[model samples]
Target: MSRPRCERCLRAQDHCLCPLIPHLQSRTRVVVLQHPSERLHALNTARLATLGLVNAELRVGEVFADLDQLLATPGYRPVLLFPGEQAQALVGYAQEGCELPFMLIVPDGTWRKARKLLYLNPLLGELPRVTLGQVLPSRYRLRKAPEAGALSTLEAVVQGLNVLEAPGCFDQLLRPFEALIEGQIRAMGRETFERNHGGR
Candidate 1:
């Protein structure tokens, strides 16, 4: 049999829906530290996040080797987006008078890889960790997470921007993810409305 079609965007073999990706500009930048394993996966949300946000950057590697170089980038604050009681909640930075340029760093991979990234990267360990307080469900249907509220890369970016009170940017960055997922769902003859949510 031929290769299986994408359940979300029913493109034929080699004609994936990822090419139609869109990006949005925001005051805050999004940096996706993706695992090499997720680079080609159809269900990887880092691709979706990069497609959705113009300012988003995707780095595929096991560790952030150039951590200092990334930190030296002009006009950008870096915050790791992860959920944990021990993590430094993001509410502190949401206030005014904070730095103008900042990056929301998200590790894209399985829980094990994500934990490894966090543990191995000394620079990342130095930065403040942010967690989402809202208890909701994930939108990534193809993948499974241990936690019910685990969000995809796209959803995490949207929520992070919203926490920064940048709705326009959030909506802008979210559109392409929405479109791509919807396109895929429609291509598979699935209900578009059902998969409109951010997490599966």
Candidate 2:
């Protein structure tokens, strides 16, 4: 039989993450487009990010029918948090003297799946793309990063917000993510984690 779960954080009731989740607010809005494949993953950090941030939302899908309406949200400039040759550093937005806040649209999935999100949503590809200046190392100990400086969805969102807002402004957002990671490491046995990932 399956174990009981927390209605909110979805962890097993005994291992609930609800207590660590914060209800913090940010000037920049965060919208995470998560692929369905990641919805039930043991370490779905995207969900934690949305739950912690007051001005965030999580949408699960391969293709969104109302993406146009979603992107058209007023008073905030929509920007894709993806890297590319044309992508500008997010820090530059402030220097450019743009007064509007940003609606950070982040794709939450594997590299290929995230790219699929962009391919499937042509409108997302048209947005101004922004990249972080200097990315910190990922704290997602359970999974290997696809490339250098890659981060989990929650980490990416926190870094993006830190760049857009003030440094350390979104640090509290990582509490649950960290707790979840620690919990996983414990569940896996420290010997196992140390044996598998300690050298990295």
Candidate 2, residues 74-165, lDDT tens digits: the string is: 98999999999999888844665788899999999998999999999899999999989899999988878878999999999998888787
State TM-scores per candidate.
0.75, 0.95
Supply candidate 1's per-residue lDDT for 21: 57
lDDT (10s digit) by residue, model 1, range 47-93: 76776666778888887788889876888777778867677545434
Q: What is the lDDT of residue 17 in candidate 2?
A: 92
Instruction: Give the residue spans of candidate 1 off by over 4 A.
Output: 1-15, 18-20, 92-94, 175-200
- C-alpha root-mean-square deviation, candidate 2: 1.4
Clashes of 2: 0
Where does model 2 exceed 4 Å of error? Answer: 92-94
